[model samples]
Each structure stands twice: as structure tokens, then as C-alpha cells.
Target: MENELLGKFKLVVGMEIHFHLKTEKKMFCSCCADIWEKEPNTVVCPVCLGLPGALPVPNIDAVKKTQMMGLALDCSLNMKSRFDRKHYFYPDLPKGYQISQYKQPLCIDGKLKLESGTVVDIERVHLEEDVAKSFHEEGKTLVDFNKSGIPLVEIVTRPCFRNIPDTVEYCKQIQLMVKYLGIGEADMEKGQMRLEVNISLRTSEQERKDELPKYKVEVKNINSFKFVEKAIQSEIIRQRELLENGITPMQENRGFKEGSMKTVPQRSKEEAKDYRYFPEPDIPPMEFTPEYIKDLKTNLPPTPYMIIDKLEKEIGLSRNNAKTMVEKLGPSYISKFEKLLRMGADPIQTSNLLLNKKEYRNVSEEEIIEVIKNTKTAYSKMEENELNAVIKKVLANNLKAVEDFKKGKESSVMYLVGEAMRMTSGKNKPDPIQLKQKILDMLDSDAN
Candidate 1:
């Protein structure tokens, strides 16, 4: 297991992440963009339904949100952009073509940081329309056009991932960013987000540079990040085995099977020409002023990566603690905690109080600060009498654990301290060091 067995080969991955936008209307029509709420065909309109002479009118909010996402990623927002029609025929696509940004996208040249410290380069973040919902029942396929015209942002990442962990971390960071921006929930299970991963392996950097394998396996519609990692790892092993047997892995689409944690072949991959892409006639090219881009960058929220990094590096918090702060409190929630620290709250203790409380969720900055200030003045620590009563109650509940402590199971006292903390609803949780010593003394007193 030298070098984690990854030294022999490089794991190259590129990802295309589709995130549904939170716009109120469909991308090209005035139909309800809330894809999950209405009945089938109720959200459809003439424009979205692709009826003859029913022209499209783009939703301006969707464009602005994409620009916001670009600024968050440090992407270059183009002053000029336009949409194109990607020709394809399917039962769900009433128009037989998809209107998406092809040549002139709204954003370009970006990067996202993983928790592992590796940076994944962004190829583009382009606007596109979503396809309809497809259902297979009774061996027949059914289509729902209600979801057909929803706005979507396709985030394309470079083939920069070298490990399975980095890929998953990168995906999570993006998901957190989207949720923080209030664009959408980015819930993969609800089909609000979809992932397509491009994976290939090379034995040497030189060989990769010469011709970084054109053939790649694409795992599409991965509903979860854990499954994304599992699928990539299994595909890597499959490719290595294929190479060892002197067979070339064909470029194709694969699926992750939940039961086996293995990838199954889906279909032969489509080339760019297969779609017959052309400029979208129903929409006009777009142009933005320098002032617009500046305003967008100014209004963008701090990315999750920066928040976690600051919490860890500047405040001396553990990586897990920082991540928890962002996860529970949200990307913007860390700043409120920082404000409390500035008003004379210990970082570690303040984080524990705010983060571990059941009754103090989503509180305002002023309220949190007031609560912290009051706690500092009211109880320096738990009163000695209250602490004893709490410990006695904990021991009384778990008589077997008390006997176990007397029988040389020293770890049982800490367990009792945990029970006391639980009994107090985590409001007066004491330092474990002091609690453990006190509990041991109580056990010794009972024995004598």
C-alpha cells in the first residue's frame, strides 16, 4: 500500500453537473417553473410545448443567477452571449431540439477548491433547458412535459481530479455553493441536480500528454456523491483490468448499480455531431455592460471553501468543526459566529454553544451575541451543587454503569458525564476533564 497504491496510475476525471435554477418561470416561456408542484402538462405552454409560431421569451432572472454563480466561482463573465439549438429527437423533447449555450456561453475560465487542497478547473458554466420527466411503467415509457422547459445551469469541470476523494469533495463544494446562493436546493435525490462523470486512467504523465485517452466512460445521472465515488473507483478497477488483458475500453455510457456498487454499461456514447447543434433562432444574443458584471461580483456571497478555510486557519478551529459550522450554520452563518467571537466569546466554546444547541437554530446575529454575552455573566461554569445533582441523576439512571466503573471499567464515568450532559439538554455541558474526575470521586465515595 505504498503511496496508497495511487502512485502507479493517475485518476483523471471531468464532471458535468446540471443544476436546476430557481427562477419562477420556465427558461423560454411563462409557464410555471416549479417542476415538482403541478400536475403533468399543467405547467406547459405554447412556447414550451413547441407549438408552431409560439416563440420563446427568456427569463431574465435565470441569466442573472448564472452570472452570480460565475462570480462565486471566480469565472470570467462574458459581455456577449447567445443560445444555440441542439438537435435531437425524443418523445420528451416536443421541439426535437434543445436550446442551450454552445459557442458563446455566459461564463468561462473558473476554478473550485476541494477540501483536500486540490483545485479543479472549470471549463464553463452555461445555460440550458431541462428535459421532461420520463417514467417507465408496465413496460411502457411515459413523458411529462411539465418539467421540459425549466432553466438549468450546466457546470463543466476540467479533467483535473486525481483521486476519488477529491472528486467527491469538489462535487460537494459546488453543491454547497449553489445552495448558499439560493439558486436551488441542489438535492440530487429530488432530481434537482444531476452529475455526469468522465473517467480515465493513465500510467504515466508523458503518455497522457501524448494522447490522454480519447475513449472515456461516462457515468450519468449519479444521484449522490457517495455513489459517484463508488462508481469512479469501480470504473478505474475495470479499466485497469481491461488494460492488463490487452483490451481497449470503449467509450460508452455506464450506470452505477446500487446493490453491487458496480458500473453497468448503458449505451454507446454520442459524439458532438450526433446532436446536430445550431444557433437557437428563438432567442437573441445577449450583451452585458461592465457595470453589470461588477455589481454581480460585489453582491456575490463568500464561497463555502473560503468560509471553512477561514474558520480553520484564522480562528484555530479543527477542519471538522469548520466544516460543521458551514454545514449547520450555512455559508453565511460563519460570519455571525465570527461577530460573537469579536464581542468577547471564546472561539471553541462559542462554536460548541451555538452549534450544539437544539433550541438556538437560525437565530439572528444580535440574538446570538446577546445570548453569548448573557451566558458569560450568568454562569462561568456549572454550579458545583447543580453539577453534583446532574451527575447523581445520571448515575441513578444507569446503575449497571456505576458498578462497572467500580469494577475497574474507568471509561464508564465519562459515559455517565455524557448522560448528564444529555439530561441537561446540552445547555450546561461541562468540560469532560472536570466532569470525569468528579464522577470518579462519586463512584469512590459510594464504594467506601
Candidate 2:
């Protein structure tokens, strides 16, 4: 059903995305950061466990990585930034408060342009420590401190999104960008990243374009992009219904219910004042020189946009195919792809093997070349006379496909080529493109 208030109200959305940094140690302690495979609570240390007399220390590498992402997003980096204590009480939080940035965020004023050409404005990119993992079973709640103190970077965007598609695309681009930067894997399934949506609807068409609604609803801890899209749509409907009845929606934190498309209220959304933010006393404020920031920016890797462009323009892959290759193979594997190209491998064939052939994805450059060579050698071994005979037999077997090809359905030629391949053994089948041309030539001869 169409939104009852589509034209009467405007949708304003912003997002707060938190992702773990691929640092070697915890943000405030020296505990190992690779706790994904470890037993719950086993990786905990005094600082991460919030034990008495333990002080927190900042991870310099995590700081740099956060700034690196800021630079990629065209944000201004602050030479002076500090961690503040955000007080809250939850089972997942070992510390009564989380160390986060409130006032002096590391990066600010960035924008990311979506594929549809709509630009989303980023308010600030800040650094913070993540909370522990919480699992609910039956009527009880369990907490694991293994995830506690893990370095997290939060990207806050302005209320710029007006639709769901652009919002989803922005999240996808952010994922790809993080991988390209080698900062984080951003695997949502593995808890490396999480998404929160801040959404509201303006009640009046007469409201200024830039004016926000009196109330907003926050949907928290959404793990999947599909869930994000669904949650946003469901919340829009829920809020619209309330407004339609002359009732204002409450400002609150909500969660997408598991196995369903609906959102349920979690709590009343807390403003900054409720957090009781204060600077961390244990860790000193971080300060960097312009020269240091400049050096880090200079050494940054290529963005996902650059990789996709190269794959499409230089390697002759379609735009959609190029994006798929980048997403599946990642930017780190670009070197291996270039090596295959240097060894005279076809771009389209290599892309297909990498994407569809699971085993080929991890094979070395030499193995890929050998496979391509063997395919070529097999096609060459089939004598022209024998190949022509095989093609004729395929045409006879699939007369309808041949007829379609004759009637200008060029796609039918591929069907006949597959038939020809099946009619021969391991070393007798020709390369698909080469076989197609020969089949076309034979069909032309019969027509003449």
C-alpha cells in the first residue's frame, strides 16, 4: 500500500555506523584484538574487565585508522581530540560508562556520494571503545567481555537521506571502503560492524526544507543491510499512522525484532545530557601535528571507486560485473588479477572463475594461468574437421536452437556451443568464443 502521508510529510534519516578497527590490541588495554574465535570472557584483561585500579591507554594505531577513514570521506581531521566517558548501565557494559568522544571528535564535515548521485553529509567521525557481547537465551541474559574494549570508529551522518535505496547504497559503499582501506573487514554477520538509524517525519509541507521534526525514532544494533531497509520502512509506516491520528510519535530507541520486519521500542532515547559525558581521567588527550596527519593521508590506499573504475575501463568488465568482482575478491587481490592479465589470461574468463568457481578464488596466479593454458590446449587439440563434425552434430540435435539463431536470436548460438561441448570429451571441446564463430560460419554456409 502507498504511504498514507507520502506527499503530506517528508522523511528525514541519518545513520550512526560503528565498526571495529582491525587493530592488534584492545583500545584501552594490551589484550589481543583477535578474539573472534576465542572462548567467551577468556580474552578479558583487567582494563577491559573494568577491574579496580586498572587504567586505560589509547591505541595509537586505532586512532590513525579512524583518521584514515575520515580522510577517505573528505573530512577535516582535528589535531586535538580526546575520549570522554559516556555513562550508561547495561549487562553488556562491564564499565558503568563507555569511553567515547563527545565534543572533540577526530574528524568532521565529510560527505559520501551514493551511486545515484545524492550526497549524504557526515557530521562527525569519532573514536570509542566497544561494549561486550550480549546473548539472550530463554528468559535470561548472558554477557561476554571478550568484545569489550575493542576499538570502534563511529561515523555520524546528517539527516540527509530521503529514501531507503540511497541509504542502503551508502552503507554498502562504506563496507567496501573499509575493506579497501584494510582498516576492518566490516563483516556484519561476524559483529565487526553495526548500524543504527535515526529517522523522523516532518508533519507539515510548510516546514522549512532544513527543519527537523519535533521527535525522532532511533532503531539500534541492526546487523544486516536488508534489516536496515526493512526497519526503516516499517518505522516510517508506524510513525505515519501515529501522526495521521493527530498523535506525535515518541522519541525512543527501538530494535528490529528477530525473524520479523517490525520494530519494537527499546527505551526512551537519551539525550547527550543523560550520558553525563566527561573527559577520561586515565588516558591523556591525543594530539598530532599537521605533518603527521599529512603523512598518513599521503600513504592511504586507493578507494573502492578507483578500483571499480579500473576494472571497468581498463579491464573491459561491465559496471555491474566490475562491482561484483571488487566486492567478492576485495581490493587486496587486485595484484593477483593483474598478474593473470599479464600472463595473457582473458579478463572476462578470469572474473567468471573468481566469482563462480569457488576453488579458483584461492588458487595461485600460476595455477590460474595453467588452467587457462590447458583450456586453450584442449581446444587446439581438436582438429578443425573433427570440431566441424561435432558442431554439425550439435546443430542436428538442437534444430530449434539453430532455427532461433538463424532468426536472429544470437543468444541461441551459446546453447548450441554447450551442446557441442557436451558431444566431445575432455580434450576435444573448443573454447566457447572460438566454437561460436565456427558454428556461425557453418550455419552461413548451409544458408548459402
Candidate 3:
């Protein structure tokens, strides 16, 4: 089936994502990269400012973090990679050029598999220096050099995406990966992660008579994932309308307007010739030996998918719970919860405590495991008198909850179970599931 709005064409989209690396300083300068929390222009240095005499020294940690990122993406580590001068002139670029990779990138040939079984091929992951942010204030624009020269990584994907949801999912997956890697925050609100969507309309599979589109229109620097999705969908519709009217869409760079939910052209697309890319004389080529890449791999954490798989397989966590754990919690938190699960904690209860509440932050792992142990021990069928006595006391203490439960709010029984657990002293504690069933039987008997 084809989209009726698109007529004879199908959508093809690729994304270029930029993430600010979590390095301590600028990519090629000693200036602190922690300027996000600082006032403007205070975090600049001569090297970051691109003064005539100043030279750039590469950040080895940034390179290593990039390779670690590559390993997490299942990308092949480029043993030999180098940086080049991407010459361009903009108010934000003090150097009138950017130090980025062109021919040889740091990582190559990776694949990101979505949960829906769609695998998008990664073209390359390259290292680069960030440009200063431009702020348009009242009657004038301001440039903040504090963010200039921050270490950044650019991931380019092949044009394999055909729908909006898959594209959004891929973006989300990458955000989770970088956060888990601890390489970058990938925070969209902070301008840490940016998305560039390249999309074009091509003839549908059944409509082979129509000519395919040759030019790609890129919507760049989308700050939010929702906007990125909307921009792609809007571009598809816009391009299809052009083709239907017998006009070819122009190749241009565009920006997403949130108020209108439309993509407006920023500038006509420029070729590599416009930038005149060449080798950067200030920085030398980066070459990593087998031992270095191997060492980098050791520091890399497991991918989010792997962590999700482990949680689901080992603990019998629901798919949704596993996804939440992998996306919301970092590698350390996931590892901690996995250890507790291995210690025989109930997955359902532990997962509930892990998320949807912040109180677990104050609870220790030992304390959580102790509760699980007590619950398991307490559910071994106490003497009938003791069980009935605990239930009676719990029901008495939670009369409102009892009434609510009898009045068809079944969820109130869990509150009564908490009371029953509180009534049991010592190492014995009630499992909410088992206690709820016992209370149900007791209430039914009273009714009869």
C-alpha cells in the first residue's frame, strides 16, 4: 500500500546527527567545555577563538570516546583517520573554517536495528569541532564563543528510512546509546544533540513509469524529536505535490517552523566545492593501533538493546519495563538492578520500585533484596489462625480500602496488602500478590 497523499511517490529519508562529546575541554583548545553552565564569552581561549598565531592540539580523550561510541554502535573502528579543514564563513565560526573529517572518518559501516526489525545502515561517525551559538536578540544578534570548539561527533546514516515513526525511533535509539555510553548527554534541550533530516520522494514500487527524484532537501538542526518527525512528513507531502504538478523540487537546506509545523528554506544547497575542504595543518592525522582500539573496546559498555535483552531474558521483565529500564537508567543502574534480580528479587515488584517513583533512590540494594526475601518466606502458608489474624488486623486497619475493594475498586486490595505486610513483624513480610488472593477468599467467605 502507498500513501494517498504522496500519490505515486514513496519517501526516502536519512539523518545526520551531531552530539556534543562529554570532554572536559574544547576539541583543540584548553578552554573548558563546561560553558553550558557558565556565562557567555567567559570560557573562550585564543586557540578556541582561532587567533592568527594560536595552534590547535587534538583531544585524545575525545577520539577515544568516539571509538568507544563506534564500538557501541557496532561500527568498524578506522585504524587510520584524520581531520580536515571544512572551510566556511559564518559569524559563529571565528576561524572561518571548521576542523572536521571528510575522507577518513573515525567509525564506519555500522547498523542500528530497531525493535520493529528495521536495520538502518550507518555510513560514518566522524569527529568535529562545534561552532559558537548565535542568538538573535532584540534589534541585534549575539554570538557566544563559549560553546565554540567543543568536541562533537557526527553520525551519518544511509537513506534507508521510508516512514516517520522508524526515523523517530532511530533518533531515540541513538540518544539512548550515547547516554548509556557516557560519551555525551545527547540532550536536545541543551543543544547537545541535533538532527538533520535528508528526505526526497521517489516513485512508488507499483508506479514505475514516473521518474524518481534526484535532488535531496535537507531539514537541518531540528532541536526536538517531534519537530524532526513532523518536518520529514511535511517535506514528503511538499515534494510529492511538486512532482504531481510536473515540477522538480529544488535542492535546498531548510528549517522547521514549530508554529506552522512546516519546513521553510534556509538556503540553497551547497556542494563540497563551496566549502573547499582540505587538510588541517594545525592538527595531525589520527592513527590508532590494534592495541589502542582493543583497549577502547574494553571500556565501552553494552548497547541498550543488549541490556534490554538481558533484563527481559534473565528477569522475565515485560518488554515495556525492559525498554524503560534501558532508556531511563544508565549502565550502572541497569547493572545494579540485574544483580538484585539475580539475588532472587521479584522482577515485577523490583521493576515497579525501580521506576515510576523516586523514593527508591534512598533505598539500598540490600534493603530491597531483604524485602524480596521476606516476601518469599512469608508466603509459604502460615498456620491458618495466624494468617486469618494478620488479614483481620490488616482489614481492620484499612477499613476505607476494604470498603473501596468491596465497592469494586479492586486496586484497593493492594493497599490492604501493604497493611498486612506492615502487620507481620520480624523477617516475615507479605507478598502483595499472595496476600491479595488470601484477602479475596476471606471477603468471599464473609459474603456467603
TM per candidate comes to 0.80, 0.82, 0.82
| lDDT against the true structure, each candidate | 0.81, 0.86, 0.82
Q: Write the per-residue lDDT of candidate 2 for residues 349-410, one digit (tens) a residue.
A: 77766765678767888898887666553334438779888888888988999899866587
- Candidate 2: where are CA atoms >4 Å away? 1-7, 137-140, 203-208, 373-448
lDDT of 1 by residue, 1-448 (tens): 2124334666778999999999889998888787786778878878888778989888899999998888888899999999999888888887788889988999999987665568789999999889888889999999888888899999998887777777887788889999888887888877999888999877776455755765789998899998897888788888877866778789999998989999999978999889888888768899999988888887887777777778889997766567767887774556667777887777776776666674665776667667666663333454777888888888899999988876557678778888877776455666664565567657756764
Candidate 2, 409: how far from true, in Å? 24
Clashes of each: 1, 0, 0
Best candidate, lDDT: 2
TM-score of 1: 0.80
lDDT of 3 at 41: 89
Once fitted onto the true fold, the runs of candidate 1 whose alpha carbons sit more than 4 angstroms away are 1-8, 205-211, 310-319, 331-346, 362-429, 432-448
Candidates, ranked, lDDT? 2, 3, 1
Shift in Å, residue 132, candidate 2: 1.7
Worst 10 residues of 2 by lDDT: 373-382
Better of 1 and 3 by TM-score: 3
